[model samples]
Target: MAVALITGSAGLIGSEAVDSLVARGFDVVGIDNDMRRRFFGDDASTSWQKSELERRHGRRYVHEAIDIRDADALMTLFDRYGDSIRVIIHTAAQPSHDWAAREPFTDFSVNATGTLNMLEACRTHCPDAVFVFTSTNKVYGDTPNRLPLIEQDTRWEIDPGHPFAEGIDESMSIDQSTHSLFGASKVAADVLVQEYGRYFGMRTGVFRGGCLTGPHHSGTMLHGFLAYLMKCTVTGTPYRVFGYKGKQVRDNIHSADLVSAFHAFIDAPHAGEVYNMGGSRFSHCSMLEAIALCQEIAGRPLSWSYEEQNRVGDHIWYVSDIGKFRRHYPAWVQQYDLTALLRDIHDQNVERWHAGATR
Candidate 1:
């Protein structure tokens, strides 16, 4: 049986990948230990999503509560699947910068060494399987903050004449900037993915993504920006804005849209291909703008306060240039913009938020 193996299988991206791969008729094996609960608290746990995936897909979806950091366990899993596994999507990571500082070893072991284990397994067993990594734009670190920006009422805008005004492309350097502890670990993993393809000749692709959000995201204040903001709006939970006078900008992409891009790459696998993937200019907003949109869409006011001290290594402005990915996969289209995206999140999870509140 053709199989699709996904790490972080219960996360926003991994769960979405599970649904997509399973629908396309692949037996899916998922690896997750719900470490998010450790990183952020019970509120950010993905256990519910794990159960939902099993309930929805039944025998087709197999959930393994395996930690990717466990090399021997991963090796065994890969050997069992062998050449039958057609694709490996690695979306699992300690996703927050603040959390990384608290536990550097845990972050590095999972993000860097964990990736190595996956690559080694792919090399030893399913050498032909396409490996896709969900890398973060934070790899560029605070470098994006160096852009020429104008402070608007609710947002920071790049000069229209600026080369990157359209969006930041793959040309931007990932070095010589202050990457947070989390970003540093991801960089190690990102480079390793590229090296595996370039050196070992594996079919691997790296996607340097912006804010990847969706209705399924177990959003926490520490990560999952748009999703968490919407949750606070819907539930009347207090939210806090950090840094840049709440005008720091970011781009958002829905999980389904990103998974579609993965399909395009998997259908036509490439070696060591890296793309800057996100909503780009089409779906970007500053913190204030996002708060406003969340409140409007959720039909509730968000209780929020701004902190003068911004999070260390946070970007003041970032919008991805997806031209490269589009140029490669012309048929792939981005379906969600900010309003449509927030609306989708609100529509899908309003009841869940309300339920959590009543309980």
Candidate 2:
């Protein structure tokens, strides 16, 4: 059986990719040291998800609790697997802009240096493997915030006449913008992934993702916006809405939908390709809209408050233009819209809470 290696394998995207690849008959190896707990405390631990994957997949899934920053350990695993590793899905990251500021060194070490380790291992051990990096839309930095936006009663919308009314595409500049420390680290990794494909002629695809969300997310204040919002609504926890009058908009794609795109790229591998992956115009919500939806789904009013200051480098409006991805892979399409996606998150959060499984 071909081996499929995944970093951040307990994460929302990583776990989804593991299940998808295993269903396709590949032996899966997952690398996750549960760094999330270190980043966001016990509430954000992914240990439960890691255990669940091991239980479900049995011997087919090999769980390696090694930090990607440990070059020796990663190299050892790569050498052990050798050329049998057919795919590498890199979803591990220091995902929060706020948290990245507090510990810039740790963020850079994990997001940038760790990615280098993975790239080198792939180059040496499995040069033929399809390498998929789950890059963030933040790589564009605050560039999208400069767009002309019109605020309505509930949300912010890009000006209709603006070129980006449809959504921001890849042509937007990644330079001369206020990228928080987290964005900078991701930028370093993002460019390196592209170069690996272009310079080394390796098959690497960088997906600049928007809000990637699903039930599996261990939501926290600093990350997992949709999941955290739903969790707050379900548990009667107070939710804080920062900046843009709670009108800031985000396009959210379900984890399953994003994983489907990865599968599409794997089937027809490309070298040094970049795609803006998100819900696009088909599925998006503002903070206000999201709260209302969560409240409706949970059958309880969410206790939310607004703050004047927004998170540094946070986008006021960001909806990805997925036209390029769709044109390239006609078979790929979104399976969940905004309402359905929120409902799923709400139901899952409630179930987990009631089961006392909030790990």
For each of the candidates, the C-alpha root-mean-square deviation to the true structure, in angstroms, is 1.1, 0.8
The TM-score values for the models, in the order shown, are 0.99, 0.99
Residue 284 shift from truth in candidate 1, angstroms: 0.6
Question: How well does candidate 2 match the true structure in TM-score terms?
Answer: 0.99
Per residue, candidate 2 scores C-alpha lDDT tens digits across 110-143 of 9999999999999999999999999999999999
Clashes of 1: 0
Pairs clashing within candidate 2: none
Writing each residue's lDDT as its tens digit, candidate 1 over 83-175 gives: 999999999999989999999999999999999999999999999999999999999999988888998899999998999989999999999
Q: For candidate 1, what is the lDDT? A: 0.93
| Candidate 2: residue 230 Cα off by (Å) | 0.6
The number of residue pairs in model 2 that clash at the backbone is 0
